[model samples]
Target: MNDKQVMVKMVFDRWYALLKNCDTLLNSLTDEQLLREIAPGKNRGIYLLGHLIAVHDDMLPILGLGDKQHAELFEMFLKSPDSKSTEGIPSVGELRSHWSKQNVMLKEKFDGLTADDWFGKHNSVSAEDFIKEPHRNKLNIILTRTTHLAYHHGQLMLIKQ
Candidate 1:
């Protein structure tokens, strides 16, 4: 395989591992535990799952994959006096199913892109500012995004205390 393909494969493997870890961690939480806030101002397991899904949903489009827009998913996690309760937090089973679907969609989207397509420049806004940057390649974007998710996952693990 070419270097680009090899790189994509590596990113894909890491993404798969992240998903597996999330599934395992989530599976260990009881419904009551998932809904219980570990501490004041801290997100519950359900909220974390929603946030994770939101991150992937928001970023996938930037990688050139047109999928469902779930921006509101993240908004629900934000602290607001008017914010709704975690009652809407899907069950671990439901989150797993959704995660699996998204995983498949991600793999298909990544697999369909050509090496040139992966490296093509697209106008992408940075998270901190509106400045545009060329998203080097889907593999690069995926790697960065995976790191972000993994970081959050680590935070989620700390909630077990």
Candidate 2:
């Protein structure tokens, strides 16, 4: 095991551990609880769940893995804040299913990447730009998204009140 491989492993470990922690927190909430806002009128627990799904779902194409599965979620969860009326949002059941499937698929793709592959530019970057900005790699996505999950995990704790 070389230094690069060890560093990559450490990052992946943090990503996986945080993801699992967030999943456990999300699972503890009931469907009714999910519909309730994390704060008085802020984003709902379920909205945050779907937002996470949509963001993770996007990583597939961004990382050159494959097309994302839940484009519809973007309108409700990504494009805008949680609405007072539940017009275009997916059901809590459907969001949970999508979240599970999206994570499993991403994990498979993530597992297959070699340490060298992790340092390669993602699909969204140009080869010229990548040459100048080598840090815009696929592994960076995992690091950033892990932090994102952690941020939401703290917000989710507010839902219990």
TM-score of each: 0.75, 0.95
For candidate 1, the per-residue lDDT at 56 reads 82
Each candidate: RMSD: 4.1, 1.1
| Model 1 stretches with alpha carbons more than 4 Å out | 38-40, 69-71, 78-84, 87-94, 123-135
Give the clashing pairs for model 2.
none
- lDDT by residue for model 1 over 12-60, one digit each (tens)? 7888898889778777767666666656777666766776777787666
Runs in model 2 lying further than 4 Å from the true structure = none
Pick the TM-score winner.
2
> How many steric overlaps are in each model, in order?
0, 0
